[model samples]
Target chain A: MASDQKVLELNDLNVHYFTPRGAVIAVNHVNLYVKKGEIVGLVGESGCGKTTVAMSTLQMVSAPGRIVGGEIKIEGQNIVNLPEKELRKLRWSKLALIPQGAMNSLNPVTKIKEQMADGITAHEKISGAALRDKVLKLLNDVGLPERVYNMFPHELSGGMKQRVCIAMAVALNPAVIIADEPTSALDVIVQRVVAQTLLDVKNRLGVSMIMIGHDMGLLAQMVDRVAVMYAGNLVEVGPVGSIFEHPYHPYTQLLIDAIPSTKQKKPLKVTEGLTHDLRNPPPGCCFQFRCPFVRDACRQKPPEFKQMEPDHFVACVQYN
Target chain B: MGGLTRGYFIQRLLMFFLTIWIGVSLTFAIPRLSGSDPTTAMLLTMMNARGYVENADKIIAAYKESFGLNDPIGIQYIRYLWNVIHFDYGFSFAKFPAAAWSLVTPALPWTLGLLTVASVLSFIFGVTVGSLMGWRKTPRWLNNILPVSLTFTSIPYFMFGILLISIVAFKLHWLPATGGYSRDVNPGWNAPFIKDVLAHAIMPLISIVITSMGGWALGMRGLMIGVNNEDYFLLAQAKGLSPARVFFRYGIRNAILPALTAFALGIGSLIGGSILVEYIFAYPGTGYTLYRAIQEQDYTVIQTITNLIIIITATGVLILDLLYPLIDPRITYKKSVAS
Candidate 1:
């Protein structure tokens, strides 16, 4: 039972950003999960609120933005309204982060060993030789040389720094690691290496992960399941292979078609219409504005998730 | 190595001397360009004093020969350079027969002692207040209250000094009105003398710290705010580092880099001392001495003091340049090897 239990769950999660004029619903009533040892890729366009979901899961949506409603459960423990101290305890030890922009994720002035060690000491009571040995072992686990322990962030290349982040995330063997677009800033070659490192770490540690990105191709190679978001809504989620083969959502199809290939040239799919304003989403299926099969019935009420097949789900009027 | 590569070290060392050389050479040229020889300046003052003189040209020629003013400009410059290095300034112009070094030596201790304490105190208070104001985690009440405390910054420092002198010294009779120390206490390493000096220092110290620290606070706040938005800062928080660790190691450590450059400029002015504050309190520091020298047209004291200030400022910047690579690893790019 424990083996198959979900490690992380976002139940009807909602994030809103407070603005002077009105509150912008950044992440609307989203539901997703990462089962034990699973790596689920959260793919979406830029500013579609995938990042807001990640931050909400971490209970770290900065001011001007707040988690209005949701239950974020890690190992079945709800952390949405958890106190600051309890939240700190839950972090790293239960929920780690491989943050985006690995190029700047590391503190520039601090040495690598200390940066790696400080996080460990924050939760545990290891010091001196033991701490040094732990940090060195982490570096080795991430395939970094022993010499890297003495270097600063600037001394290490971008890929190596991302690996350091990967190593840091697993320091406490957290239940879930939300890697927010971890490969966005890297080049193609290093992106593959870093993606492989994440998978390797997942395989070795049996830790669950939520890899957020816009690169459909990269996610296909790495993630077990794909969770696609559009304008803060979870449009589709299913096993990665089936979703790529039979993407039910029109936006998901467009996203998949836009993926580059060496075999043939393809026109980039331009969606039909713009995303409706988040502050006041219209009373209808969210995809009605852009869906090719928009009908009068689609505008009657907002569509809820309709089970399309085993382990696959879609939110659209046609599916309903 | 802390990024202080050997080549960079050598380069910095050369730059240090180059700055001093350029500054000293400018000091040399400016006086000559004004076309007022010391002997001529002296003669003109004498003429103003007595209203007549005989064989002024012959006297000027004799004085020039004795002072080596008749020598080639290049030779005189080299000789002057040699003299400055050794502190062999002959005598004060206003107080003849008294060495130039002697005129400045007594004031040096008072100025250095007061300004060092005040400047250091100001820097610490400013950094703490600034880092707090910059930090998002700081308590709302404290943040709201901090700006109110900076009200003194709106009032000029010397004006604040005058206010303190009027209220604390003149009106309430709480401390002495002026001077480095009480006239009653003998100048020595005694408790009474030290106490008197410290007591007299409080007003000036408060005025300087209160009025000037706002700038450091404002500058640091901006830097901290900028650093607050850095991905590293947010990641540090996500790493579950305690507020203290994240605030200090990640926040201040990076934000303090640009502030260090500003601090070096503070050190420059520290050595020169605050002329207005010193004059206001009659603190008998270098600033007050320089002010008196200006008033008296004492060229020897003024030139010596100005040259000292320039050297000190150059040294401060040089020290900062050398220390930068240690504090900021990104500054280590020397371009000698592959970047």
Candidate 2:
């Protein structure tokens, strides 16, 4: 049965970056949805609009980048045209972002406790003991000790800093959290610790998450569903198990094949051809140039998303 | 204090004395090396004007002996250094029979009163406005304020002073033109005397404030713009911080650090005074006193005032060094211990 409850819904989302080279379509007619308590992973190579989609969800995209079209509904409320004052209330309390480079994302001059409390006290009236208690509780939730409260950002190690970011992200008990490459900058062991901590926090709170990363292997282990993107298009999306086991799109198949595995004693497969330039993207399927199963019809126009199974979707002419 | 900070404290303490020593030594040496006997020059100029050359030889000999001018250069340097420690600088040739201390001390308060108040006002006003300009992507009309600030800062300080005086003082008659206080008002703690002193300070204060405030405003705006683009700022916005909170807590807080440094380093320039402004306003600040000292060959008064300026500037640097650790906790002086 399809769930009607969705924590976030991106309907025909189109985001463009107006640069000196002209308007580059960063996200083109992309549609994605995250149901309540679901962890959706947006996996793609760099410059594939993975981060842009996440930032657009919170309406946090900076200048020269505009969501020219599309509707972003959080809990069924369209946030595309929301006023700044109203948008601020939705941020952190309803939709928070665990930005990349967790260490540098924090204000270096502020203490961990104070920075965390800033998010809490923004929409609520909590002071003194109550504020400290709330911040400490959230820190404890993220597997950080209370000693981190008084410490400045520079005093904390990279993993500890990432933990503080996680704590800050969930400080207001937001309904949805977007963790963008949260563990990219950490050591292998520390990355596992931080990743596990994020999962524990999300599971404990029962909040939906959109984890964006290029490491499909890590995403497969962590997310319930995964959306694979290529050249600013959602090439394939389905349950993590099916997406990993039976990828329908050629791009998805190539990505999974490229990942190193212990079960297969074969060498890693490398895909050929450069990704289409965002400033001057070719017509028809974005993956047509690099696709192994490219057809004459694929050159006519970009393919629309077609349902291959009950819950799986793929954008390719062959699927249609 | 913690062990890490103790190193910083000790380092700054040593620097404070080192700077003062070098400053004082240079002041003592420069005047002697400039190749002119102060007493003889004074006698030549004053006596020549008065047509009293017959008695000039005796007076010059007596003046040199009294002023210790015949001593060896190195010995004089030592004696002068000792005199600085004791706050003694012989006598003022320009003021005839008056001691150098009497001329410098009276003028010190006027300059301090004007420059200190003006600098503080400029910093507060400039930083607040500049940060606002930086945080918001204002309309095209609002950005016009930046070019105006550039224009004000580009004008030389003294020229700005003269222009302000010509318009506001001479033509507009909105304020007094010259002097620390009206000649009619007696020097005292009374309201009228205080009012008169402040009235005379207006033109010079305006000159300093207008020029410096522009520079500080432009500098702060640049810093704020850079800081606003930092990843942390974007994260702060994403975390749902209010625009006002984000602007103040994150934007200004980081942006103001560079402004604070600029302000501290700028203290040395303040001690030098708005020289031409003081001369034009005829304000009895050290700049005007130094001007008269130069014209009249008053070497004692010149040496004393220059050393005073240097000492105050060195003290300002020491204060700034100490202030860094307090305002920013990241500036630790401790060396990392190798594991």
Candidate 3:
């Protein structure tokens, strides 16, 4: 249902970083779609290309990391071929990013209201009372007191700052919001509050979001669909409940097993060995060495993603 | 609140007085400790006749009375401190009857004008160049230029000054070699006077700029590099900020904080350099007057000039320290106390 209403369609997206060592494949032929008014969670362990995928969506990847291949279409328009100026026009208006470590994201010297005003003024022509009112409304919408507008970022607590970041992200009411580990730095309580605030904003504003995180449980609460990534490739993707209940890919299974559960009396299932290094990734199944169910065929050739159920895709020799 | 602030103000004032006292005591004792008697020097210079029967005690007594050197150390210190507080530095021994303060006052503006203009120009140029080089990583041209620029910055300003004087003034004769202005023109606020002063300042200004711009560029470049790596800058880019805005608004603001502190400290030391540069150019500035006072061992003039420098430097540092809290809220008195 969510896949059918696609708002952002990434086709064969590949991102490579030019390091002194060589060209490292950070995101390899990854394809996914984010639908309108639905949250899509991109889950992966550290250095698994999830963040790279999100960064490439907005063309925010810095030097050395270039989106070498693929097409990114937003609202059916191919953004990959668009000029930087046109791409910039799409950002914050068509697609906004809530970057990692939202706590320190704000300008320390400027007041919160001024920071919001900067965001507003960047894309719009409103000023004076209208701008002030818009900033005040934004502050209020993020569950922050109106008085917070006058305070500097240093004056606010970490949680308040994160809310300010969210406010800034959603200020222009962009169609798609990419939040990369927005609540990772906060405590559990603050994390919940921030997550809920994100959800609340999405629900009220009807903005599609791409939530990136390593934690399945956190993403489980916010996202409608989950795309699991491993070794710079998307191994599995499905509806949130389907992926969580019956994960097919060995990597997805291990990721779910690794999650701590209070109800389960048995010891937590931990995946052995580290993730494959992208610099010299194995030719075959990237996770074969770490997979418990690896077969001879798994070492011979990488398995392509096959749909076992409608909109539920998994790439594994065992599943095939 | 007022009382607390006033108390803090008073504490700073007390510290200022203590610093001056220590400086004066060191100056006075150093001459005595060196086993050099001013009285003996004066007597030797005064005596013209060969093998004249000189009563040393009488000569010392007369010298002590004439110069108020007969007073007890404590009494003299108190009198000196009083004179310093009142800004009444006595006459110069080198030019008797001419007040030291009067000589210093006229020279202060010339030195300050040259130093201020040169320092500001160099700093601005350096920061601009450094920031641009640091932000744009792709251009191989910047990578090639940065090291050469840093090498230029590492050379001492005095060496640069001498080099400029040799090349531009003496060898090339493109500029006047020495003296603030031509002998014919009297120093005034008119166009001709200003032009002459500026013409004379050209070599020194270039020397100062070449010597100082490198450090500013190096400092700004390193800072900009660090700031560019920060998450907030990345966030600014992610928000679709223009490269220029990100470079200036986010990158420059944070990067330039360290440069700002350095600049503040530099403003204070500008006075110190003014003396040296002025002396080298034979510019009629406070530095030249101070040099004359030192040669004549004019105690009052020396004390007054030294005190003015200390006061100016101290005040400049205080202002810079105060500005830290405003620029970066993380800086505070509590942090200083804790450290």
Specify the highest-lDDT model's number.
1
What's the lDDT for candidate 3?
0.80
Q: List runs of model 3 lying over 4 Å from the truth.
A: A1-3, A263-271, B1-53, B65-73, B91-99, B137-151, B274-276, B287-302, B321-339
Ranking by DockQ: 1, 2, 3
Chain B, model 2, TM-score against the native?
0.89
Best by DockQ: 1
Candidate 3, residues B195-279: lDDT per residue as tens digits? 8888998977877787788888878888888877776777777677677777777888788888988787677566656566667
Candidate 1 has an lDDT of: 0.88
Worst 10 residues of 3 chain A by lDDT: A265-274
Span of ten consecutive residues with least summed lDDT in model 2 chain A: A264-273
Name every residue pair that clashes in candidate 2: none
TM-score of candidate 3 versus the correct structure, residues matched by position: 0.90
Which digits, one per residue and each the tens of the lDDT, describe model 2 over residues B1-339? 112377788898899889988989988877767777777788788877888777778888888888887888778888888899988998888887899988888888888888889889889878876876787545568676655654677788888888988899899998998889998998999999999888888788878777878777878889999988887898889977877889888888888987898788777666556778788888888888888888887888888888888888888888988887766767767677311
| lDDT by residue for model 1 (A125-167), tens | 9999999998898889888999899988877889999999999
Q: Who is ahead in DockQ, 1 or 2?
A: 1
TM-score leaderboard ranking: 1, 2, 3
Instruction: Chain B TM-score per candidate, please.
Output: 0.95, 0.89, 0.80
